[model samples]
Target: MEHSDEWTFADCFHAQKELYRAIISAAVSIRWMIEHDFEVPTDADLRQMEAEVNRELCDAWVEIYVLALREWLDGQ
Candidate 1:
Protein backbone atom coordinates (compact mmCIF):
# COMPACT_ATOMS: atom_id res chain seq x y z
CA MET A 1 0.00 0.00 0.00
CA GLU A 2 1.12 3.61 -0.71
CA HIS A 3 0.12 6.95 0.75
CA SER A 4 -0.31 9.93 -1.56
CA ASP A 5 0.55 13.53 -0.77
CA GLU A 6 0.04 16.96 -2.43
CA TRP A 7 2.60 19.40 -1.08
CA THR A 8 4.21 20.88 -4.17
CA PHE A 9 1.15 22.95 -5.06
CA ALA A 10 0.84 24.19 -1.51
CA ASP A 11 4.51 25.14 -1.39
CA CYS A 12 4.34 27.10 -4.64
CA PHE A 13 1.18 28.90 -3.53
CA HIS A 14 2.82 30.04 -0.29
CA ALA A 15 5.89 31.25 -2.13
CA GLN A 16 3.80 33.28 -4.59
CA LYS A 17 1.80 34.84 -1.74
CA GLU A 18 4.93 35.94 0.08
CA LEU A 19 6.47 37.33 -3.12
CA TYR A 20 3.35 39.44 -3.74
CA ARG A 21 3.38 40.79 -0.17
CA ALA A 22 7.03 41.78 -0.37
CA ILE A 23 6.46 43.59 -3.67
CA ILE A 24 3.51 45.55 -2.25
CA SER A 25 5.34 46.51 0.93
CA ALA A 26 8.34 47.75 -1.04
CA ALA A 27 6.16 49.85 -3.33
CA VAL A 28 4.38 51.36 -0.32
CA SER A 29 7.60 52.48 1.37
CA ILE A 30 8.83 54.16 -1.80
CA ARG A 31 5.54 56.05 -2.11
CA TRP A 32 5.67 57.05 1.54
CA MET A 33 9.10 58.61 1.10
CA ILE A 34 8.04 60.50 -2.01
CA GLU A 35 4.85 61.83 -0.42
CA HIS A 36 6.56 63.05 2.76
CA ASP A 37 9.80 64.93 2.17
CA PHE A 38 10.34 66.64 5.50
CA GLU A 39 13.52 68.34 6.72
CA VAL A 40 16.47 66.54 8.25
CA PRO A 41 18.53 67.30 11.36
CA THR A 42 21.47 69.75 11.70
CA ASP A 43 24.76 69.69 13.59
CA ALA A 44 24.88 66.46 15.64
CA ASP A 45 21.42 65.73 14.36
CA LEU A 46 22.74 65.96 10.81
CA ARG A 47 25.00 62.97 11.34
CA GLN A 48 22.16 60.88 12.74
CA MET A 49 19.86 62.03 9.95
CA GLU A 50 22.39 61.09 7.30
CA ALA A 51 22.77 57.67 8.81
CA GLU A 52 19.03 57.17 8.88
CA VAL A 53 18.65 58.23 5.26
CA ASN A 54 21.39 55.89 4.15
CA ARG A 55 19.79 52.97 6.00
CA GLU A 56 16.36 53.65 4.61
CA LEU A 57 17.66 54.00 1.08
CA CYS A 58 19.57 50.79 1.33
CA ASP A 59 16.55 48.88 2.63
CA ALA A 60 14.28 50.37 -0.02
CA TRP A 61 16.69 49.46 -2.81
CA VAL A 62 17.00 45.91 -1.56
CA GLU A 63 13.26 45.50 -1.53
CA ILE A 64 12.92 46.91 -5.04
CA TYR A 65 15.55 44.53 -6.33
CA VAL A 66 13.92 41.58 -4.66
CA LEU A 67 10.57 42.47 -6.20
CA ALA A 68 12.14 42.83 -9.61
CA LEU A 69 13.81 39.47 -9.27
CA ARG A 70 10.52 37.90 -8.28
CA GLU A 71 8.88 39.36 -11.32
CA TRP A 72 11.60 38.00 -13.55
CA LEU A 73 11.31 34.59 -11.94
CA ASP A 74 7.60 34.56 -12.53
CA GLY A 75 8.20 35.29 -16.17
CA GLN A 76 10.54 32.34 -16.52
Candidate 2:
Protein backbone atom coordinates (compact mmCIF):
# COMPACT_ATOMS: atom_id res chain seq x y z
CA MET A 1 0.00 0.00 0.00
CA GLU A 2 1.23 3.40 -0.89
CA HIS A 3 1.66 6.07 1.77
CA SER A 4 -0.28 9.25 1.24
CA ASP A 5 -1.42 12.24 3.21
CA GLU A 6 -4.89 11.61 1.87
CA TRP A 7 -5.27 8.22 3.50
CA THR A 8 -8.50 7.83 5.52
CA PHE A 9 -9.46 5.87 8.62
CA ALA A 10 -10.95 3.09 6.50
CA ASP A 11 -7.69 2.82 4.59
CA CYS A 12 -5.69 2.52 7.78
CA PHE A 13 -8.21 0.13 9.30
CA HIS A 14 -7.96 -2.15 6.33
CA ALA A 15 -4.21 -1.86 5.97
CA GLN A 16 -3.02 -2.02 9.60
CA LYS A 17 -5.40 -2.89 12.37
CA GLU A 18 -2.57 -3.68 14.79
CA LEU A 19 -1.06 -0.23 14.40
CA TYR A 20 -4.46 1.31 15.06
CA ARG A 21 -4.86 -0.81 18.16
CA ALA A 22 -1.43 0.18 19.40
CA ILE A 23 -2.24 3.86 18.99
CA ILE A 24 -5.38 3.47 21.08
CA SER A 25 -3.51 1.47 23.69
CA ALA A 26 -0.77 4.05 23.94
CA ALA A 27 -3.29 6.86 24.37
CA VAL A 28 -5.05 4.95 27.11
CA SER A 29 -1.76 4.20 28.85
CA ILE A 30 -0.93 7.89 28.90
CA ARG A 31 -4.33 8.68 30.31
CA TRP A 32 -3.76 6.16 33.07
CA MET A 33 -0.36 7.60 33.82
CA ILE A 34 -1.78 11.10 34.20
CA GLU A 35 -4.50 9.89 36.53
CA HIS A 36 -2.19 7.90 38.80
CA ASP A 37 1.02 9.88 38.63
CA PHE A 38 -0.32 13.36 39.19
CA GLU A 39 -1.83 14.65 42.39
CA VAL A 40 -2.97 17.92 40.82
CA PRO A 41 -1.89 18.27 37.23
CA THR A 42 -2.48 21.71 35.77
CA ASP A 43 -4.31 22.38 32.52
CA ALA A 44 -1.04 23.31 30.88
CA ASP A 45 0.51 20.05 31.93
CA LEU A 46 -2.40 18.11 30.50
CA ARG A 47 -2.21 20.01 27.23
CA GLN A 48 1.52 19.43 26.97
CA MET A 49 1.13 15.74 27.62
CA GLU A 50 -1.64 15.47 25.07
CA ALA A 51 0.44 17.19 22.41
CA GLU A 52 3.50 15.14 23.17
CA VAL A 53 1.59 11.88 23.13
CA ASN A 54 0.00 12.69 19.81
CA ARG A 55 3.33 13.61 18.25
CA GLU A 56 5.08 10.57 19.59
CA LEU A 57 2.32 8.18 18.59
CA CYS A 58 2.13 9.57 15.07
CA ASP A 59 5.89 9.29 14.63
CA ALA A 60 5.85 5.78 16.01
CA TRP A 61 3.02 4.69 13.73
CA VAL A 62 4.74 6.02 10.65
CA GLU A 63 8.04 4.43 11.54
CA ILE A 64 6.49 1.07 12.31
CA TYR A 65 4.31 1.11 9.24
CA VAL A 66 7.28 1.85 7.00
CA LEU A 67 9.34 -0.87 8.56
CA ALA A 68 6.53 -3.37 8.18
CA LEU A 69 6.09 -2.39 4.56
CA ARG A 70 9.80 -2.81 3.95
CA GLU A 71 9.76 -6.30 5.41
CA TRP A 72 6.74 -7.23 3.35
CA LEU A 73 8.41 -5.95 0.21
CA ASP A 74 11.60 -7.80 1.00
CA GLY A 75 9.71 -11.07 1.28
CA GLN A 76 7.96 -10.60 -2.03
Task: Name the TM-score of candidate 2.
Answer: 0.38
Clashing pairs in 1: none
Residue 52 accuracy (lDDT) in model 2: 71
lDDT of 1 at 45: 51
**lDDT per residue as tens, model 1, 1-76:** 5665534434554565556556655654455456556434346654544555556555565565665556556655
Once fitted onto the true fold, the runs of candidate 2 whose alpha carbons sit more than 4 angstroms away are: 1-37, 63-76
lDDT of each: 0.54, 0.63
Model 1 misplacement above 4 A: 1-7, 38-76
How many residue pairs in model 2 have overlapping backbones?
Answer: 0
lDDT, residue 62, model 2: 67
How does each model score on TM-score?
0.40, 0.38
For candidate 2, lDDT tens digit of each residue in 1-76? 8767764544544466466556766785578577778456568766776677666667577666766566556554
